[model samples]
Target: MSTPHTRRSFIGHAAAGFSTLALPRWGQAQPATEPAPRPAQIEHAVTAPVAIEVNARPIPAFEPRDRSRTRFGSLQYRSGLVLTSPHRGFGGLSGIRVDAKGERFLALSDQGSWFTGSIRYSGRAMVGLDDVEAAPMLNAEGRPITEKRLWYDTESLARDGNLVYVGLERVNQIMRFDFSKGGTRARGEVLPTPPAVRKLPYNKGLEALVFVPKGQPLAGTLIAFSERGLDANENLIAFLIGGPSPGQFSVRRTEKFDISDAVLLASGELLILERKFSWFTGIDIRIRSIPLKSIAPGALVDGPVLFNADLGHEVDNMEGIDAHVTAEGETVLTMISDDNFSLLQRTLLLQFTLVE
Candidate 1:
């Protein structure tokens, strides 16, 4: 009885190999530091990524006693829309909108003590939460903010709607939450990481936020953080405008080109999503695309596997990606996964159509 489009084609065909992740004993105590600074001009061009065609369908999701564990790491996209959260949950569904108002909104973020509710999208569409509240205790800049600091992953929502950039990751800082400042606790202000990534070591937070479009000469909004570790030597850093305030971020290095589910690909390019599990072989995931001027920081290119799900195709933990247009004009890519509530792990939504 599978049918979420056949469990996303069984997660793109049962899954296979691409292993190389080993660096998380608890974090901290591994920072020789020295790799950051690449991209003088970078004009390399060599497209590959062209093998994603899973429509077998059937993804209801459930398979997480411990398939590795990772509910939500980072993701945010606006207008065309996308948002998520679940690595640990006090508040489950964080944000996800694919508007014109066709309807797709599942928002919440109170993980400080877990009291989220009011997530709607069921009837069979999937995405279900309830209506919880009572977990917010914000005060910052005035004190009284006891723990439950929110630990937020990363978020962005400010083309000009009135700011919404969150990245507390336990408190390295990157606030900005002022939904017009009416009241929701409002307290967003920090913004400035880059003393060589705040000095590295354990401060390891910040996952994803892409805004790009402030003024030129070098505008702003292109954060992308996730040093989780596994390859490319580590240090997946990139920050240009940054905003909020602290020292004003500007670090760099992204040309190493590895695979870890990066985003921001409206033809501007730079899409990386990967996951491959193994018990013997029972999970698969892939999505790749690069062209952000070929990438700069550290400049070390080599990504072109594109799609290879045991060769058949199947997708499960393929977390976040956005770039919609469709109606004939063409150009659609919507993917989401982060069901760490663990029944087995399933909360996926994938749709692709971009080839040029």
Candidate 2:
């Protein structure tokens, strides 16, 4: 562990060493000018899977001002990385799924692209990445999903064995892919969803997904959560699809946070990763642990906040979360950020140990 003085000294030296680097400050004020027209969305249509080089810079401490204090809420800081890639299509990572062994990872950008890679670890601390590849998400006809209008914005991801489910926010639809067929090359078919799902508010719909595996409380269920789709009672609307009790439920929304991603733990806990942006405070991210058994048709579920962080911490647009148990029986939570392809934002990958 790094001490505050040492960390500060190292950072000062690093700043001096890299003073010429043009990285944008997170919340610096911009010069006022006439608003520019929004540019057309960049399409990351890859003909096939292609390897990409990504650079990872180690973040020695989560809270730079107090490096020695590792414990925060119900988690203990482990390691983190500030990830960057020269590839133009490399950001906007909305969701991620890590293998059980905490090695291989599958991630997707909101621009309808797949990023597959493995985490290189040195004694449980992430060193960097290896074997990273980028590919466009394909549709039923083997064409890039982004080739269609309003078919991108792939925000949430869930995995059950070789089967993968992705939730697209722009169209409020779910697409299924079988990795066994061709890995990221597998074409996605639109999964049938309830009529209400298509009625969710565009851009705010279908932000988080968790697939309950066999032997779980809601086994064989695809749990979907909207970013801010609210019910008449003002709670966030969620759905249980293809489960024994397939219906709609509500997640009690508080603190102005919206759902970004979620992971269902083997311990019967549903951890929802949420974030909220404010001009006054920048951005804030949090994790709430709700019991899996408490969710059912028409049930209103709520949980205790397990963690929270703000811009004062080394955070950006924190968007994705996943967990894997280490050999020592420690549940390690991994988080990734979506830069929104903006110079002022960054893509951060952070990890923590869930201290039960």
Candidate 3:
């Protein structure tokens, strides 16, 4: 993870092979979303029409021709690449979701912003991105909620139809926004989080969440996972809320990584994204998928680590993960990194196919 910094600097210069789209021509036909709201207690003055300008560049390689057999547990490389923008507020991305078609995507920045765009691919490898828009998450008053107490660290997101839930880490609260309402008026209202959520360490609270679809084992349930919160038995704590299995659950933590994000597979399994870092080891990331049949009240769920990678593999602070199926009926997992707005780190978007 990039070290947290306080200074603000916007790198507006796009390097070679980069592309940008400002208003009018941008967001022409995409989903309607409000502009970044009036920033609350922001550091810089809001002087531009766009709150966050995106600079996208192409990254054309995944694996070499002779190295097609590469595997990490049950995951095989489909394609992966890096994304970098000089928007000082662009880092700390923690939540992501791709549309049913796997074409459009929505993600949340830990610093309190929303990123939406189309994923560009060349044949099978991700080549670049287009139609990108980054805006601040708005409060009920039509203002950026960053002004609220310890509220900027938006960490987890889940979508159920038009309802979107965002988990703010430091704030230990869930904000609900109804996208069913059109663009300019979809300001958010806070949801009633379980009392257990507020008791977790502020920084490690609510790192991942996913809504159980109507046909799933825990149908209509919302499973919220913490970054590092523990149970009475020292196991990682998760909450089962708003469905048949409403209570507390646990997932065994191994290899010293905390949960970063998670996704619900079509078969009702939970795929977890985790990361670990140390001065000597730099950064390491992994994924573990457990069956929903095994998740219940007080259940200790553990699954084989499906994938693991490090900085050597072009991975940065790989924090966001979501799964989608391609037209060919293959499970493609997409992951993105939170650069923490630090110059030393590069925001990355990666894709892989699960072989098991």
Best by lDDT: 2
Please report how far candidate 2 places residue 84 from its true position, in Å.
0.6
N/CA/C clash count, model 3: 0
lDDT of 3: 0.74
Candidate 1 vs 3: which has more TM-score: 3
| Cα lDDT computed for each candidate against the true fold | 0.38, 0.85, 0.74
lDDT of 2 by residue, 212-292 (tens): 999999899999999999999899999999989999999999988899999999999999999876655556789999999
- Per-prediction TM-score, please? 0.25, 0.87, 0.83
Clashing pairs in 3: none
Superior by TM-score: candidate 1 or candidate 2: 2
> Candidate 1 at residue 270, lDDT?
59
Clashing pairs in 2: none
Q: Summarize candidate 1's per-residue lDDT along 175-292 as a digit string, tens digits.
A: 5556476333455466565655444334344444445444421235455454332223443444444443222222223433223345554456556555555554545555555555
Ranking by lDDT: 2, 3, 1
Candidate numbers sorted by TM-score from highest down? 2, 3, 1
Positional deviation of residue 244's Cα in model 2 after best superposition, in angstroms: 0.5
lDDT of 3 by residue, 1-356 (tens): 32221111111111211423211111223235856534442312231124344555543333332254567678877776667655545656777899876778888888777777888877877777677766667788766677575777789999998888988888778888897874313678998867988998868888998889988898988899999998877779998978896888899988788999999999878999998866556667888889998999878999978887765555667779998988888898989887665554567788888887
